[model samples]
Target: MIVKNEERSLERCLQSVQGKVGEIIIVDTGSTDQTKEIARRYTDRIYDFEWIGDFSAARNYALEFASSDYILHLDADETLEDPNNELMGNLDKDFYYIRIKNDLGTGLVLTHQFVRLFRNSPEIRYKGALHEQVQLDHNIHQYGYLSTLILHDGYKDDIIKSKQKAQRNEHILLEEIKNNPTAFNYYNLGMQYIVAGQYNDALNALKKSYTLANNYTFSQKVVLEIMKCLHELGRYQEAVKVSMDAVELYENIPDFWYQLGLSYLEWGMLKDAEDSFNKCLEIGEEKSQELLNHYDGTGSYLAQGQLAKVNLMLGNNEQALEYILSAAKAAPNVTGFFNIFLSILPNASPKELLQHVIHIWPYQTERHANLIATLYQQRHPLLNEFITYHNLDVEYPISTLHYIFENNYERALAELNQQSQKGTDHFITNNVILLSFLLNNPNLISEFKNDISLSEKEAKWFKNIILKKVPTQSIHVNKALLMIWKQLILDLIQLQKYEFIDLLISATKQAEFRLIISECLQQYGFDELALEVLIECDNSHVNRQVYMTAAKSLIKLGAAEDALFYLSKAEGVHLDFNVLFEKWRIASTIDKFEEIKILQKMIQSYPESRWAKRTSGAILG
Candidate 1:
């Protein structure tokens, strides 16, 4: 083995081969520390060589000192895992490829096979200045593989940063490219650039290597690297085209399909992305052992996560949950897997999703608390059960929200009072103000209004409740209050509480809240008030939901032109069935035949529903 400044790892490397190998030969180029001293304890065959930028030259120099019939080479940071007698009994093969598991710092393990053990002969020598390869003079048909595993952690980020290995490799590779000008040199340079996070440089070098590469294996490697560089550069179209070619050329590689899926996802081609990710999973499951060293294993957990994301995009929430659960089981410590699972919760039944989250609460309690609180605010059942099971009665936001949702106003107020004595958190104070308003206690609102630091939405709610006056001008609105007000307005509208609705309308000056008030007015058969509110409101503060609602209100009032204008504002947002049907209805009323066709196509692409089918029939008929 040839090494340089590996004092921390040299002894461990030597110990792994103890009693398993015939002789230990180490060639040290330059080590300022105790690397030589550590080697002296294990082997007496340690030799010194002058520092040159060529790894192959130093490796070849070390090879000359070996006196065994078979030679095994390993780095100072690598160790053999349980070397058995059967592995050493493989004397019939001229060379053997051994599995190397490289631990990448991104919580991933990559496995690849390398020819580490070969017969000792004068005809065989090492080649290349960087990423040195072993070359043999004659064709050896007796090559086989060994089950011996080697664990390597030298490529991890902390180790790489301390050693400055990428910078060193880049310097040697650039010199090699100048002197030798080989495809292998360019490939090594591209890989080094990749390690240095220089995607543009990596792309150029890998492209050059691809053009010069004659070997299929090297060409495939170059293509994958180029695809990675393009993906990182946000060149999704180019990445897709290159990955398609790669998938066609190297159908056995799962990484190509996985990358293609990622590119397609970025390009908003959901169906294509789904197909590619599924293909990756299929190939990965079948060929789990043929993993690449530079890439994470696809079928193990990474592909499962990607498949979960793809399924979520396709609106298959149940399928997404299944894949995510499997991925979480495979990699429970990976936060991304659980994050994807949380994202799919909104698409599922709230109660059922909450139960699932509760089951996995121990894995990530903090994350589960935030997510469960969000769904609980949407009025999902079992909040009390969740609070009791997790012993979250003493927590700030969850406890406060639990009391508010339970309609135990006295208990809720007492919890807020207790929390306020400890210190004031902005979110907790805001919850206290909101609960006070819900309880219809003007005294409580007056008490909390001065001391509580409120967000813009909480400030709006606070002023509206205490002052009982609406601002005549527009202000920046809080989106969370819009949802909260939406639920509250629906309840008030059911009870015919028009006086309280008017007070709400008068208190907040934001156009967004005015839109909500207008909806409440329309529900009470107050069309004139609703239309007046919509006209007085500014369009800048309105969102897609508001625009759609305004358009529907205008359509009901026989103002089709005004309805079309609001519909145009809702174009870029993700359209639900209601929005699409409304757009189609407006188009049909206005005799806009071209828009009818586009809306019909969009409706058909979405899942078939009663509204979708009826809308399609109306447009086509």
Candidate 2:
């Protein structure tokens, strides 16, 4: 191994191979620290070499001192992991391809095979100044693959930052390219540019490599790097074109599809993104081994998880749900996919979510049941109104929670009817009340409100907000209960639970709440419901904003005459062009208002403006 100033990581690397290897060969390339002293703890076969600005030269020097038949190469930041000796103990081929895992410091391990173990002979020697590759006579080398991995710590962000390796690598690769000027050397320079985050430089070198390299030799890897550089540079169209050519050449590889999907996604070409990810899933199974050859999880979870986000953005909620659940199943140990599933879930009724759950994780395994229970255990939004609704008066989490978890109105309601007329458990009573509202049988709330386990303040909140048709001004709730109540209001709006929303409207006649509810409903296209709430907002005392909002919602419902009615009650309306024009437009539809009055108002407000000119031309032309 050739190293310089690797005191921090040298001892660990030496210890990992102390007992496993026959001899340790260390070649110091002018290290200013105690790296050689640390090596002395294990072996005294340490040799000093001058800094020649070429790694291959130092590595070749170390190769000359090895007395063993095979030379296993490693850097100070790299170590052979467990069960490594077994591979080293046997030798059927001239050399073996050892998998090196690069620690990206991103919770991701990148694996690539290299000819690190080989017979120590005069013919076998590493070439190139940086990112050197082992070369044999006439390029004829028998390489074998072993499952043993070498953990590399050099790529960690902190280590790279301290080492300033990108600058040094850039300098070496540029100097090497000046001398050799080969396709492989260009690819090396491109990789160094990428490490330096100089994407434009990477693209230029990689493109040159692509043009000069053989069709199949370096094209696959260079194409990938070129596409990545283009993506980073915001040249997505070029990236997609390059990726497509690669896909046609390597059709079954999941890596190309995965990369192409990212190209489309980052460009906001969502449909193409969706299609590419689906293709990854399709070819992932048949090409499972190749899928992991690059871009880990492309074959299993990455594409599936990413597809969930794409579908959600495209407004395909059901498809998004299926994709995310599939991602969770594919990577059950990865909590990130499940978190994506939660985030992608539509603000929908429990009945709507039940369909996706039943088919994905069937109730036989109790996984679907447990998943449903988990949501309710956290008391997530439950704004569903069956108008049809159950009673399992089971036990903190639920007797009614069980019924809700079942997500079955018929089964839950049947079970509830079988229970005694009144529930005995306190928390069960509270759930029964909530279930009653959820199931659209609000009358059941009266039967269980007395036995609810909620604190007295919570009871008053529940009664005043959900039960009594009075203003909530008199009740004082603590912060926690208030938060739950606010979430309930948001859920009711988001879920469009019209029946329960109507119940809340009747429970309080406060104009502020009515206006708030109306606005939220309109945001989700529930304009008719929004208009109804606005109508009950004490229109006689309401301002211009309420009147204008009500008129807009009325217009959406094709209620032009009623829109005029609300506009007629409008007060404190400023002489704005949009407001006046809308009122005039609606008024012109009916012969009810004097059009001349609005025409005069428009003319008088902005006599020298376009509004005045436009209205004047139409009025007197």
Candidate 3:
């Protein structure tokens, strides 16, 4: 083994192969840490070497110390997962490629088969300054893959960033490219830049490598790196073109198909994305290891996540849910799969999404619980079932809110009664108790009304929920009261209890609540009622979201004048792309030619904005 400053990992590496190997040898290249000291505990055959930029040189020097008939090479940060003497004895080949799992620390794992175990010979050596390759006479040497696996975490993001190891490798690779200008040198340089997040540099180097690459495997690696660079640069069209060319040449490689699917998704080609991702799944593992030698993990897991996204975009919620759940099952710790699942939850049917979340809850309870809590906080329907299914140890008030949302008022009251016995009397719990009293015994509000003290806003909200009355004047609202009020409003909406909505409207003077009420009404197909709610709210309120929502609702109700009024109110307070688009719609509706001139000026001011993109015919054209 060739090592430097690997004290942190040297012992573990030595221990993994302590009893399995006939002899151990360690060649240190100027380590300042206790690496050599630790190596002394395991082997007396430790040698010191001068610092050299070339990895192949150090590795070759290490090879001279091996006295065993067979040599197995490993880095300090890697460990032989399992070593079997019987398996080693059965191997008659001159060399064997062992599986290496590279953990990138961002939940992205790449798997590669590397020639690490080989028969000791004078002709066998190593090549390359960085990412050195095993060199041998393949015509005379027989090499095949083995079931033995090596776990490596040296290339993880944090380690790479902290150590700047990629930068160090880049220097060596640059020198190698200057001296040799080989396809392998350019490829190594490009990959080093990729690890360092220098995509443009990576792209230039990878393009050069592609020009010189002659071996099919080397060319495939070049194409994948080029596609990755283009994808990161947001050149989706170019990425798609390159990926298509790669797929035509390497149709059986799953990575190429997965890359094509990603590019097609970014380019808004849903059908093409679906077909490409499906091809990845259909191709399976045949020749996959050869094509994905430097990458870890199968494309199947990521392909499922992509398919989930594609199905969601195509409005196939059930299929999307199934695919995402399957992905979560395959890789529970993969944040990308969970992210896609969460993105679809807001649009999926509440009960269906809840059922799927429950199904996966047992696999990764903490992750699923956090997700369930987020959905509950968003007032997603059927949250009562989620809470009940998991028996979540959440606060009483939130659980009571879910029960109310599920229209199980009796169960809601039961939860309140159970929590009341605990003697916890916070504002939220007190408010929930009062809500339960009102739901179970409407005439008994006077009995419990004086027992709980609430802020003026909370009092107003409670009065509205209980008495169904609107406030006489607008007042500043507290955030906590607003959250509780919003959840209550969502519950009433789900139960189709519109009669209580009037009270909800009256309970808060904040334009935010009025906007929420307007949106809920609109969602329930009461466009005129939504407009009426928006019209009643003071337009002087400078919240951009409220103004934009009001403008849209007014325009939907054929009240262009009212829409323009709200849009104008949002002029300086929130001049974002959405607000700009709303202004354009108002201008088009009222035939105000001057307003179009203002829009042109606005688009020029924010040329990269989505509103500008739409108006300039750059997107969706």
Candidate 4:
């Protein structure tokens, strides 16, 4: 293994393969930490190599001491997931593709096969400076799959933040591109920028790589990255254009269909999205994993999970649940999948929710309990019974939620603040900011907001939400972040945080948005709070459903006059007689004879309609 400052994971990697391998060799380029000390515990063949800013150099130097005939290489951040000396004992190929599962921060995981195990031939030396590859150019390069898995945590958020390898690799790859411009090097640089969230630069580099790609071995992979970067940059049309070309040439690759589906989903073409995702499922898992930089289960569970979203937005809840259940069963540990569960079957009683979750994840590991607990936390009545039944200790965030549920906002805020200082979970940090504002502690709000990670869309949402300023952009939103705000709304209603809730309503501008908050408030018997939302809408009930909802809310609050006024403000949507009849009924009940007579004339416009005739006859009598 070639490593530098990998003390945190060096020992773990060595522990996985210590007894299995014939000999272990660790080459340290330069490490200020206890990496060498840790390496010595497993291998006496540890060598100190001078830092030359090239990974292949260090990797090749490490390989010089490997006495094994068939070599299986690993990095400091990688571990053999199973003690499979039996699997190792049966290697019979010139090279093998090792399955690597990468934890790419958040709940995102990607698994791909790479040429990590190969015969120790001189011609099979490493190539490239930064993103090195096995030199598989020789005629003897016959490769097959190795069943052994390697869990790689090199891209986990904490590790990425501490190591900042993305930045370093970006610089190195750029230099390599200048010196020797290979398609692979540009691809490497594009991937580096992608990890750094520079989607525009990534797209540029990936496009250049596409133009120079003489060999079509990883050409589909290049197209994938370019399309991915385009999607990230919100160039949906361009992404779909590229995706169309890619899927035509590489029709067998499920990822191309998946990418096409994502673009269609983003562009609001739900039918097209449904079609693309179905196509992906039909393609299923196939070969050439080593040729693509992709995720695990793209065609099967991943595609199903995405299909759940499409169906959810399409209002097919039952279909959505089926797809999600399949996905959750496959990867029950992913918390986001459960959130989607909550989004789909939100009305499921708490007991049913628990039972449904237990059905999906029968094993009560911490992962299973956490999924149940997380689902519970999003809704009401903290599930202490379930927690006790599972015999699991609650962790932070969830622990904080208990305090919130118990109406101990002060204690919750204190715990959240302390937790914010230690580490950051975006959800937890968002709650900390939320509680600060809800508690009328604006001073703590700024400090807490900075603790949470923000994507561009999310940053806008936070700024707009915190400022109690209505959003000016598209009403379509970021689902994960929207859930955070949804929780805040629920908290506001639960805790009777009326003033803050009003500010929240006052801050929002979208008609659909105002309607949602108002309707939520209205359903919970907060008509006044609902009014805080409805009163903010433009004086038009014709097109806007919110105005009609507002008029109904006002009637519930015994503001008949105000209700009639809202009902009469009809310009946007058609002035249906149902609305006019509602206004007439209110006017008659409130003893507004003159207003009723005027409404009778206005209702006569639709003379042939039953509602207009009823209004005219009622007024005449």
Per-residue accuracy of model 4 over 1-621 as CA lDDT, tens digit each: 887888888888998886677888878887899999998888798899998888889888888888888887898888896555644587777888777989875356777778888888887788889868888854656778767888998887778888877777887898888899988888888888888899988888888988997466666678888889989989887888888888888888788889889987786556567788889789886632644567766777778888999888655889999999999888776677777777786545556777786688677565766665574556444354356556767667676766666668888777786787677344664566566675655455456555765455655555566666666765454456566666677767655666777677667665555666777676566778677765444434423576677787888888888787777764236565446655666766666675566466554643323334455577677
Model 1 regions lying over 4 Å from their true place: 82-86, 137-141, 286-296, 333-335, 346-621
lDDT tens digits, residue span 458-510, model 1: 66555655566555555555666566566556444433446666676667666
Cα lDDT of model 2 overall?
Answer: 0.68
Across 355-429, the per-residue lDDT of candidate 3 in tens digits comes to: 666566454665666566555545556566666666766666676766666567777666655665465544343
Candidate 3 global TM-score: 0.63
For each candidate, what TM-score against the reference? 0.63, 0.56, 0.63, 0.72
Candidate 1 RMSD computed on C-alpha atoms after optimal superposition onto the true structure: 9.6
The C-alpha local distance difference test score for the whole of candidate 3 amounts to 0.71
Pairs of colliding residues, candidate 1: 470-506, 470-507
Q: What does the lDDT come to for candidate 1?
A: 0.71
How good is model 4 by TM-score?
0.72
Per-residue accuracy of model 2 over 364-386 as CA lDDT, tens digit each = 32342444354554444431221
Please give the CA lDDT of all the candidate structures: 0.71, 0.68, 0.71, 0.73
Model 1, residue 544: distance off in Å is 8.8
Number of clashes in model 3? 7
- What does each candidate score in C-alpha RMSD? 9.6, 15.5, 10.6, 11.9
